[model samples]
Target chain A: MFNAIQHYRLVQRNRNRAGLGSWHFEWIYKFFLHTGTSRRKYLVEVRQYDEHLYTVDFYAKVHNVNRYRLRTHQHAAGKLGATVLAIIARTIQQDPQACFGFIAAAMLTETTDENTRRFQLYTRMLELKINPARYKVEAFAENSTIFVLPHGLVSQPDALQNTITRYDQIFREVF
Target chain B: MTKYSAKSSKKADPRQQAREERKARNRAIAPERIAKVHIMADGRKLLELKPVQIPGYTYAF
Candidate 1:
Protein backbone atom coordinates (compact mmCIF):
# COMPACT_ATOMS: atom_id res chain seq x y z
CA MET A 1 0.00 0.00 0.00
CA PHE A 2 2.78 2.40 0.83
CA ASN A 3 4.42 1.48 -2.45
CA ALA A 4 1.27 2.55 -4.22
CA ILE A 5 1.34 5.80 -2.25
CA GLN A 6 4.96 6.38 -3.20
CA HIS A 7 4.14 5.65 -6.83
CA TYR A 8 1.34 8.21 -6.76
CA ARG A 9 3.70 10.75 -5.22
CA LEU A 10 6.28 10.05 -7.88
CA VAL A 11 3.66 10.56 -10.60
CA GLN A 12 2.78 13.89 -9.03
CA ARG A 13 6.46 14.84 -8.91
CA ASN A 14 6.81 13.96 -12.57
CA ARG A 15 3.73 15.97 -13.47
CA ASN A 16 5.20 18.94 -11.66
CA ARG A 17 8.54 18.45 -13.36
CA ALA A 18 6.77 18.36 -16.71
CA GLY A 19 6.08 22.11 -16.28
CA LEU A 20 2.41 21.72 -15.40
CA GLY A 21 2.60 24.06 -12.45
CA SER A 22 -0.77 25.67 -12.95
CA TRP A 23 -2.62 22.63 -11.59
CA HIS A 24 -3.04 22.68 -7.84
CA PHE A 25 -2.68 19.26 -6.21
CA GLU A 26 -4.15 17.73 -3.09
CA TRP A 27 -3.81 14.25 -1.62
CA ILE A 28 -6.95 12.42 -0.61
CA TYR A 29 -7.10 9.05 1.13
CA LYS A 30 -10.20 7.10 0.24
CA PHE A 31 -11.04 3.88 2.01
CA PHE A 32 -10.96 0.76 -0.10
CA LEU A 33 -14.34 -0.84 -0.46
CA HIS A 34 -13.35 -4.40 0.22
CA THR A 35 -11.15 -3.75 3.21
CA GLY A 36 -12.32 -0.53 4.75
CA THR A 37 -9.22 -0.48 6.93
CA SER A 38 -6.94 0.14 3.97
CA ARG A 39 -7.07 3.50 2.26
CA ARG A 40 -5.80 4.35 -1.19
CA LYS A 41 -4.30 7.81 -1.54
CA TYR A 42 -5.00 9.66 -4.77
CA LEU A 43 -3.94 13.00 -6.12
CA VAL A 44 -6.63 15.47 -7.01
CA GLU A 45 -5.53 18.21 -9.37
CA VAL A 46 -7.72 21.26 -9.83
CA ARG A 47 -7.54 23.95 -12.47
CA GLN A 48 -9.75 26.97 -12.92
CA TYR A 49 -11.43 27.62 -16.27
CA ASP A 50 -13.42 30.75 -17.08
CA GLU A 51 -15.17 31.05 -13.71
CA HIS A 52 -15.91 27.32 -13.92
CA LEU A 53 -14.00 24.54 -12.20
CA TYR A 54 -12.15 21.60 -13.69
CA THR A 55 -10.63 18.80 -11.68
CA VAL A 56 -8.81 15.54 -12.29
CA ASP A 57 -8.55 12.68 -9.79
CA PHE A 58 -6.17 9.81 -10.33
CA TYR A 59 -5.01 6.83 -8.32
CA ALA A 60 -1.85 4.71 -8.54
CA LYS A 61 -2.86 1.16 -7.72
CA VAL A 62 -0.93 -2.04 -7.31
CA HIS A 63 -3.67 -4.65 -7.74
CA ASN A 64 -7.19 -5.68 -6.80
CA VAL A 65 -10.58 -4.18 -7.59
CA ASN A 66 -13.66 -3.36 -5.56
CA ARG A 67 -16.93 -2.74 -7.32
CA TYR A 68 -18.65 -0.89 -4.50
CA ARG A 69 -15.72 1.46 -3.93
CA LEU A 70 -15.48 2.21 -7.64
CA ARG A 71 -19.21 2.90 -7.79
CA THR A 72 -18.75 5.31 -4.90
CA HIS A 73 -15.89 6.92 -6.79
CA GLN A 74 -18.20 7.35 -9.74
CA HIS A 75 -20.35 9.49 -7.51
CA ALA A 76 -17.36 11.65 -6.71
CA ALA A 77 -16.44 11.95 -10.38
CA GLY A 78 -19.93 13.02 -11.35
CA LYS A 79 -20.34 15.30 -8.35
CA LEU A 80 -16.97 17.01 -8.70
CA GLY A 81 -17.04 16.95 -12.49
CA ALA A 82 -13.58 15.44 -12.35
CA THR A 83 -11.81 13.07 -14.71
CA VAL A 84 -10.54 9.75 -13.40
CA LEU A 85 -7.02 8.63 -14.21
CA ALA A 86 -6.45 4.97 -13.46
CA ILE A 87 -2.77 3.98 -13.26
CA ILE A 88 -1.96 0.38 -12.56
CA ALA A 89 1.32 -1.16 -11.51
CA ARG A 90 0.86 -4.00 -13.98
CA THR A 91 -1.48 -5.21 -16.72
CA ILE A 92 -5.05 -4.01 -17.01
CA GLN A 93 -7.99 -6.30 -16.37
CA GLN A 94 -9.96 -7.44 -19.44
CA ASP A 95 -13.11 -6.25 -17.73
CA PRO A 96 -13.44 -2.58 -18.62
CA GLN A 97 -15.34 -1.70 -15.46
CA ALA A 98 -12.49 -3.00 -13.30
CA CYS A 99 -10.65 0.22 -14.04
CA PHE A 100 -12.25 3.59 -13.48
CA GLY A 101 -12.87 5.82 -16.50
CA PHE A 102 -12.11 2.95 -18.86
CA ILE A 103 -14.84 4.08 -21.24
CA ALA A 104 -13.62 7.63 -21.79
CA ALA A 105 -9.98 7.81 -20.71
CA ALA A 106 -6.97 5.69 -21.52
CA MET A 107 -5.45 3.37 -18.93
CA LEU A 108 -1.72 3.30 -18.24
CA THR A 109 0.30 0.39 -16.91
CA GLU A 110 3.82 -0.03 -15.57
CA THR A 111 5.61 -3.34 -15.80
CA THR A 112 8.40 -4.06 -13.33
CA ASP A 113 10.45 -6.05 -15.85
CA GLU A 114 10.69 -3.32 -18.47
CA ASN A 115 13.09 -0.48 -17.89
CA THR A 116 12.41 1.79 -20.89
CA ARG A 117 9.13 0.37 -22.14
CA ARG A 118 5.90 2.33 -21.57
CA PHE A 119 2.34 1.40 -22.50
CA GLN A 120 -0.77 3.46 -23.18
CA LEU A 121 -4.26 1.97 -23.37
CA TYR A 122 -5.59 1.15 -26.83
CA THR A 123 -9.04 0.53 -25.35
CA ARG A 124 -10.84 3.24 -27.27
CA MET A 125 -9.37 2.14 -30.57
CA LEU A 126 -10.25 -1.47 -29.95
CA GLU A 127 -13.81 -0.54 -29.04
CA LEU A 128 -14.25 0.75 -32.59
CA LYS A 129 -13.29 -2.67 -34.00
CA ILE A 130 -10.21 -1.21 -35.72
CA ASN A 131 -6.71 -2.60 -35.29
CA PRO A 132 -3.96 -0.09 -34.57
CA ALA A 133 -0.39 -1.10 -35.32
CA ARG A 134 2.28 -1.03 -32.67
CA TYR A 135 4.39 2.11 -32.76
CA LYS A 136 7.46 2.36 -30.63
CA VAL A 137 8.60 5.73 -29.30
CA GLU A 138 9.93 7.12 -26.09
CA ALA A 139 6.66 8.72 -25.02
CA PHE A 140 6.32 10.47 -21.67
CA ALA A 141 3.16 8.80 -20.39
CA GLU A 142 2.60 5.30 -19.00
CA ASN A 143 4.10 1.85 -19.62
CA SER A 144 5.65 1.45 -23.03
CA THR A 145 5.87 4.52 -25.22
CA ILE A 146 5.85 1.96 -28.01
CA PHE A 147 2.31 1.26 -29.04
CA VAL A 148 1.44 -2.33 -28.23
CA LEU A 149 -1.36 -3.54 -30.49
CA PRO A 150 -3.37 -5.27 -27.80
CA HIS A 151 -6.95 -4.75 -28.96
CA GLY A 152 -7.71 -1.37 -30.52
CA LEU A 153 -5.62 1.50 -31.95
CA VAL A 154 -4.36 2.61 -35.35
CA SER A 155 -0.62 3.09 -35.16
CA GLN A 156 -0.74 5.76 -37.84
CA PRO A 157 1.38 8.62 -36.57
CA ASP A 158 -1.64 10.91 -36.57
CA ALA A 159 -3.91 8.51 -34.70
CA LEU A 160 -1.22 7.64 -32.17
CA GLN A 161 -0.30 11.30 -31.89
CA ASN A 162 -3.90 12.23 -31.30
CA THR A 163 -4.15 9.57 -28.61
CA ILE A 164 -1.08 10.95 -26.93
CA THR A 165 -2.25 14.52 -27.38
CA ARG A 166 -5.55 13.74 -25.69
CA TYR A 167 -3.63 13.48 -22.43
CA ASP A 168 -2.97 17.20 -22.47
CA GLN A 169 -6.12 18.23 -24.31
CA ILE A 170 -8.25 16.72 -21.54
CA PHE A 171 -6.65 18.97 -19.03
CA ARG A 172 -7.19 21.89 -21.34
CA GLU A 173 -10.78 21.29 -22.43
CA VAL A 174 -12.07 19.95 -19.10
CA PHE A 175 -12.08 23.55 -18.04
CA MET B 1 -64.27 -22.87 11.24
CA THR B 2 -61.09 -21.32 12.66
CA LYS B 3 -57.94 -21.58 10.55
CA TYR B 4 -54.87 -23.07 12.16
CA SER B 5 -51.33 -21.80 11.45
CA ALA B 6 -47.98 -22.67 12.92
CA LYS B 7 -46.13 -19.92 14.87
CA SER B 8 -42.71 -20.97 13.36
CA SER B 9 -44.05 -20.55 9.81
CA LYS B 10 -43.37 -16.80 9.89
CA LYS B 11 -40.53 -15.85 7.50
CA ALA B 12 -38.37 -12.77 7.51
CA ASP B 13 -39.60 -10.07 5.13
CA PRO B 14 -37.40 -8.68 2.36
CA ARG B 15 -37.19 -5.34 4.15
CA GLN B 16 -35.83 -7.00 7.28
CA GLN B 17 -33.40 -9.05 5.19
CA ALA B 18 -32.14 -5.89 3.50
CA ARG B 19 -31.64 -4.17 6.85
CA GLU B 20 -29.57 -7.11 8.07
CA GLU B 21 -27.45 -7.07 4.94
CA ARG B 22 -26.92 -3.35 5.31
CA LYS B 23 -25.85 -3.84 8.90
CA ALA B 24 -23.42 -6.52 7.84
CA ARG B 25 -21.98 -4.27 5.16
CA ASN B 26 -21.69 -1.38 7.59
CA ARG B 27 -19.86 -3.63 9.98
CA ALA B 28 -17.42 -4.71 7.31
CA ILE B 29 -16.45 -1.28 5.93
CA ALA B 30 -13.79 0.67 7.78
CA PRO B 31 -13.57 4.39 8.44
CA GLU B 32 -11.03 6.55 6.65
CA ARG B 33 -8.02 8.26 8.21
CA ILE B 34 -7.07 11.72 7.06
CA ALA B 35 -4.45 14.36 7.84
CA LYS B 36 -4.36 17.93 6.66
CA VAL B 37 -0.83 19.16 6.08
CA HIS B 38 0.57 22.61 5.46
CA ILE B 39 3.75 22.85 3.45
CA MET B 40 6.30 25.63 3.11
CA ALA B 41 9.57 25.99 1.26
CA ASP B 42 11.56 25.39 4.39
CA GLY B 43 9.44 22.75 6.10
CA ARG B 44 6.01 21.18 6.42
CA LYS B 45 3.55 20.89 9.27
CA LEU B 46 0.45 18.80 9.89
CA LEU B 47 -2.42 21.08 10.64
CA GLU B 48 -4.93 18.39 11.47
CA LEU B 49 -4.59 14.62 11.50
CA LYS B 50 -7.15 12.03 12.47
CA PRO B 51 -9.76 9.56 11.25
CA VAL B 52 -12.82 11.11 9.71
CA GLN B 53 -16.14 10.12 11.26
CA ILE B 54 -19.40 11.81 10.44
CA PRO B 55 -22.57 11.30 12.39
CA GLY B 56 -25.22 9.22 10.60
CA TYR B 57 -22.92 8.62 7.64
CA THR B 58 -21.18 5.53 6.31
CA TYR B 59 -17.62 5.22 7.62
CA ALA B 60 -15.08 3.14 5.73
CA PHE B 61 -11.76 2.50 7.34
Candidate 2:
Protein backbone atom coordinates (compact mmCIF):
# COMPACT_ATOMS: atom_id res chain seq x y z
CA MET A 1 0.00 0.00 0.00
CA PHE A 2 1.27 3.53 -0.83
CA ASN A 3 0.74 4.96 2.63
CA ALA A 4 2.14 8.15 4.10
CA ILE A 5 3.42 6.17 7.03
CA GLN A 6 5.13 3.60 4.80
CA HIS A 7 7.23 1.33 6.99
CA TYR A 8 4.29 -0.58 8.41
CA ARG A 9 3.02 -0.81 4.83
CA LEU A 10 -0.52 -0.64 6.24
CA VAL A 11 -3.14 -1.22 3.57
CA GLN A 12 -5.44 1.70 4.37
CA ARG A 13 -6.72 2.53 0.95
CA ASN A 14 -9.85 2.07 -1.24
CA ARG A 15 -12.04 -0.17 0.92
CA ASN A 16 -9.69 0.85 3.75
CA ARG A 17 -8.73 4.35 2.76
CA ALA A 18 -8.19 6.51 5.84
CA GLY A 19 -11.19 8.76 6.31
CA LEU A 20 -10.74 12.55 6.10
CA GLY A 21 -8.27 13.61 8.74
CA SER A 22 -8.03 9.90 9.54
CA TRP A 23 -4.55 10.50 10.90
CA HIS A 24 -6.19 11.50 14.19
CA PHE A 25 -6.16 9.48 17.40
CA GLU A 26 -9.43 7.55 17.83
CA TRP A 27 -9.67 6.33 14.25
CA ILE A 28 -6.06 5.19 14.14
CA TYR A 29 -6.00 3.19 17.36
CA LYS A 30 -8.98 1.18 16.09
CA PHE A 31 -6.75 -0.86 13.79
CA PHE A 32 -5.38 -4.27 14.78
CA LEU A 33 -1.95 -2.83 14.07
CA HIS A 34 -2.17 -0.11 16.73
CA THR A 35 -4.75 -1.28 19.25
CA GLY A 36 -4.91 -5.03 18.65
CA THR A 37 -6.68 -5.93 21.89
CA SER A 38 -3.95 -4.72 24.20
CA ARG A 39 -3.41 -2.25 27.02
CA ARG A 40 -0.26 -0.72 25.56
CA LYS A 41 0.68 1.70 22.75
CA TYR A 42 3.90 2.77 21.02
CA LEU A 43 5.70 6.13 20.84
CA VAL A 44 8.59 7.56 18.80
CA GLU A 45 11.51 9.93 19.42
CA VAL A 46 14.09 10.69 16.71
CA ARG A 47 17.53 12.20 16.64
CA GLN A 48 19.88 13.06 13.80
CA TYR A 49 20.88 9.40 13.66
CA ASP A 50 21.37 9.23 9.93
CA GLU A 51 19.97 10.37 6.56
CA HIS A 52 17.34 7.79 5.54
CA LEU A 53 16.24 6.29 8.86
CA TYR A 54 15.13 8.70 11.58
CA THR A 55 13.73 6.27 14.22
CA VAL A 56 10.58 4.13 14.48
CA ASP A 57 9.03 0.92 15.75
CA PHE A 58 10.14 -2.17 13.85
CA TYR A 59 6.93 -4.09 14.41
CA ALA A 60 4.54 -1.19 14.35
CA LYS A 61 3.15 -0.12 10.99
CA VAL A 62 4.50 3.45 11.00
CA HIS A 63 7.93 4.82 10.09
CA ASN A 64 9.28 8.32 10.70
CA VAL A 65 9.66 10.35 7.49
CA ASN A 66 11.68 13.58 7.69
CA ARG A 67 10.04 16.53 5.95
CA TYR A 68 12.49 19.23 7.01
CA ARG A 69 15.97 19.62 5.61
CA LEU A 70 19.03 19.53 7.80
CA ARG A 71 21.13 22.66 8.14
CA THR A 72 23.94 20.96 6.30
CA HIS A 73 24.07 20.36 2.55
CA GLN A 74 22.17 17.05 2.81
CA HIS A 75 18.82 16.50 1.11
CA ALA A 76 15.75 16.61 3.33
CA ALA A 77 13.96 13.48 2.14
CA GLY A 78 14.49 11.71 5.47
CA LYS A 79 11.98 11.74 8.31
CA LEU A 80 12.12 14.91 10.35
CA GLY A 81 13.14 13.28 13.61
CA ALA A 82 11.46 15.63 16.08
CA THR A 83 8.13 16.01 14.35
CA VAL A 84 7.76 12.26 13.77
CA LEU A 85 8.27 11.63 17.47
CA ALA A 86 5.66 14.22 18.35
CA ILE A 87 3.18 12.46 16.06
CA ILE A 88 3.93 9.28 17.97
CA ALA A 89 3.16 10.93 21.29
CA ARG A 90 -0.16 12.06 19.80
CA THR A 91 -0.88 8.49 18.71
CA ILE A 92 -0.20 7.22 22.22
CA GLN A 93 -2.53 9.75 23.82
CA GLN A 94 -5.37 8.23 21.77
CA ASP A 95 -6.28 5.70 24.47
CA PRO A 96 -3.75 6.12 27.30
CA GLN A 97 -4.78 2.70 28.63
CA ALA A 98 -5.66 0.17 25.92
CA CYS A 99 -2.71 -0.61 23.67
CA PHE A 100 0.56 -2.39 24.38
CA GLY A 101 3.04 0.51 24.76
CA PHE A 102 6.31 0.77 22.86
CA ILE A 103 8.56 3.73 22.00
CA ALA A 104 10.70 4.43 18.88
CA ALA A 105 12.87 7.36 19.94
CA ALA A 106 16.01 7.79 17.81
CA MET A 107 18.98 10.09 17.30
CA LEU A 108 21.68 10.36 14.64
CA THR A 109 24.70 10.40 16.87
CA GLU A 110 26.90 9.51 13.95
CA THR A 111 27.00 12.99 12.40
CA THR A 112 26.59 15.33 15.35
CA ASP A 113 26.97 15.58 19.11
CA GLU A 114 23.91 17.78 19.59
CA ASN A 115 21.62 14.81 18.97
CA THR A 116 23.51 12.86 21.55
CA ARG A 117 22.90 15.60 24.09
CA ARG A 118 19.18 15.88 23.41
CA PHE A 119 18.77 12.12 23.71
CA GLN A 120 20.76 12.20 26.92
CA LEU A 121 18.00 14.34 28.33
CA TYR A 122 15.66 11.36 28.18
CA THR A 123 18.22 8.70 28.97
CA ARG A 124 19.45 10.65 31.96
CA MET A 125 15.93 11.50 33.06
CA LEU A 126 14.39 8.08 32.42
CA GLU A 127 17.62 6.20 32.99
CA LEU A 128 17.34 4.37 29.66
CA LYS A 129 20.27 2.27 28.58
CA ILE A 130 21.23 4.63 25.71
CA ASN A 131 24.26 4.00 23.59
CA PRO A 132 23.41 6.10 20.56
CA ALA A 133 26.72 5.34 18.89
CA ARG A 134 25.99 1.67 19.37
CA TYR A 135 22.19 1.16 19.31
CA LYS A 136 20.82 -0.48 16.15
CA VAL A 137 17.32 -1.73 16.93
CA GLU A 138 14.57 0.59 15.65
CA ALA A 139 12.06 -0.74 18.22
CA PHE A 140 12.11 -0.65 22.01
CA ALA A 141 9.33 -1.33 24.58
CA GLU A 142 10.18 -0.08 28.02
CA ASN A 143 10.20 3.64 28.71
CA SER A 144 7.18 5.92 28.84
CA THR A 145 9.14 8.64 27.00
CA ILE A 146 11.27 8.57 23.82
CA PHE A 147 13.69 11.02 22.24
CA VAL A 148 15.30 11.56 18.85
CA LEU A 149 18.93 12.53 18.41
CA PRO A 150 20.37 13.45 15.03
CA HIS A 151 23.77 14.25 13.69
CA GLY A 152 24.27 17.66 12.09
CA LEU A 153 20.69 18.26 13.11
CA VAL A 154 19.04 21.64 12.91
CA SER A 155 15.76 22.57 14.61
CA GLN A 156 12.87 23.43 12.34
CA PRO A 157 9.96 25.42 13.77
CA ASP A 158 7.65 24.75 10.84
CA ALA A 159 8.09 21.00 11.12
CA LEU A 160 7.35 21.09 14.83
CA GLN A 161 4.27 23.25 14.32
CA ASN A 162 3.01 21.06 11.52
CA THR A 163 3.42 17.98 13.66
CA ILE A 164 1.42 19.56 16.46
CA THR A 165 -1.30 20.56 14.02
CA ARG A 166 -1.43 17.03 12.66
CA TYR A 167 -2.01 15.77 16.21
CA ASP A 168 -4.55 18.42 17.06
CA GLN A 169 -6.44 17.78 13.87
CA ILE A 170 -6.23 14.07 14.50
CA PHE A 171 -7.62 14.49 17.98
CA ARG A 172 -10.50 16.65 16.77
CA GLU A 173 -11.42 14.38 13.89
CA VAL A 174 -11.08 10.99 15.65
CA PHE A 175 -12.56 11.88 19.01
CA MET B 1 -24.40 -40.21 -4.02
CA THR B 2 -21.80 -39.58 -1.29
CA LYS B 3 -21.74 -35.96 -0.14
CA TYR B 4 -18.31 -34.41 0.22
CA SER B 5 -18.11 -31.99 3.14
CA ALA B 6 -15.62 -29.14 3.72
CA LYS B 7 -16.41 -29.07 7.47
CA SER B 8 -14.39 -32.26 8.06
CA SER B 9 -11.16 -30.37 7.40
CA LYS B 10 -12.26 -27.09 8.94
CA LYS B 11 -11.15 -27.98 12.43
CA ALA B 12 -7.60 -26.85 13.21
CA ASP B 13 -5.64 -27.20 16.46
CA PRO B 14 -6.43 -23.86 18.07
CA ARG B 15 -3.25 -23.82 20.18
CA GLN B 16 -1.03 -24.46 17.19
CA GLN B 17 -2.86 -21.82 15.17
CA ALA B 18 -2.40 -19.31 17.95
CA ARG B 19 1.32 -20.12 18.11
CA GLU B 20 1.67 -19.58 14.39
CA GLU B 21 -0.16 -16.29 14.62
CA ARG B 22 2.12 -15.17 17.43
CA LYS B 23 5.11 -16.14 15.32
CA ALA B 24 3.83 -14.00 12.49
CA ARG B 25 3.36 -11.08 14.86
CA ASN B 26 6.89 -11.39 16.25
CA ARG B 27 8.34 -11.51 12.78
CA ALA B 28 6.84 -8.09 12.03
CA ILE B 29 8.87 -6.52 14.83
CA ALA B 30 12.23 -7.63 13.50
CA PRO B 31 14.57 -4.81 12.30
CA GLU B 32 16.69 -4.86 9.20
CA ARG B 33 20.13 -6.16 10.05
CA ILE B 34 21.73 -3.59 7.78
CA ALA B 35 20.45 -0.03 7.31
CA LYS B 36 21.42 1.48 3.98
CA VAL B 37 21.46 5.14 2.95
CA HIS B 38 22.17 6.71 -0.44
CA ILE B 39 22.69 10.42 -1.06
CA MET B 40 21.99 11.56 -4.60
CA ALA B 41 23.42 14.78 -5.95
CA ASP B 42 22.10 16.99 -8.75
CA GLY B 43 24.66 19.67 -9.44
CA ARG B 44 25.36 21.54 -6.17
CA LYS B 45 22.16 20.27 -4.53
CA LEU B 46 21.91 16.95 -2.70
CA LEU B 47 18.79 15.20 -3.92
CA GLU B 48 18.05 12.64 -1.17
CA LEU B 49 19.25 10.94 1.99
CA LYS B 50 17.08 8.38 3.79
CA PRO B 51 17.65 5.35 6.00
CA VAL B 52 16.53 2.04 4.50
CA GLN B 53 15.72 0.35 7.82
CA ILE B 54 12.89 0.68 10.36
CA PRO B 55 12.64 3.94 12.36
CA GLY B 56 13.13 4.78 16.04
CA TYR B 57 14.20 2.43 18.84
CA THR B 58 17.58 0.95 17.99
CA TYR B 59 18.50 -2.67 18.63
CA ALA B 60 21.22 -5.01 17.47
CA PHE B 61 20.95 -5.11 13.66
Best-matching candidate per DockQ: 2
Off-target runs (Cα >4 Å) in candidate 1 are A1-29, A32-56, A59-138, A141-154, B1-61
Q: Score the docking of each candidate (DockQ).
A: 0.01, 0.01
Could you give candidate 2's per-residue lDDT for residues B1-61 as a string of tens digits? 2345765656798999999999656533223322322221211211111233334644211
- Candidate 1 lDDT over A61-144, as tens digits, reads 435443112323322332122112222211122222111111123223322312221112222122111111221112222221
Per candidate, native contacts kept equal 0.00, 0.00
Question: What tens-digit string does per-residue lDDT give for candidate 2 at A86-125?
Answer: 3443433442221111232334332432223333232222
Candidate 2 TM-score versus the reference: 0.21
Candidate 1 chain A weakest lDDT stretch, 10 residues: A128-137
Per-residue lDDT for B1-61 in model 1, tens only?
Answer: 2244554466878899999999756532122321223232334221211322334432110
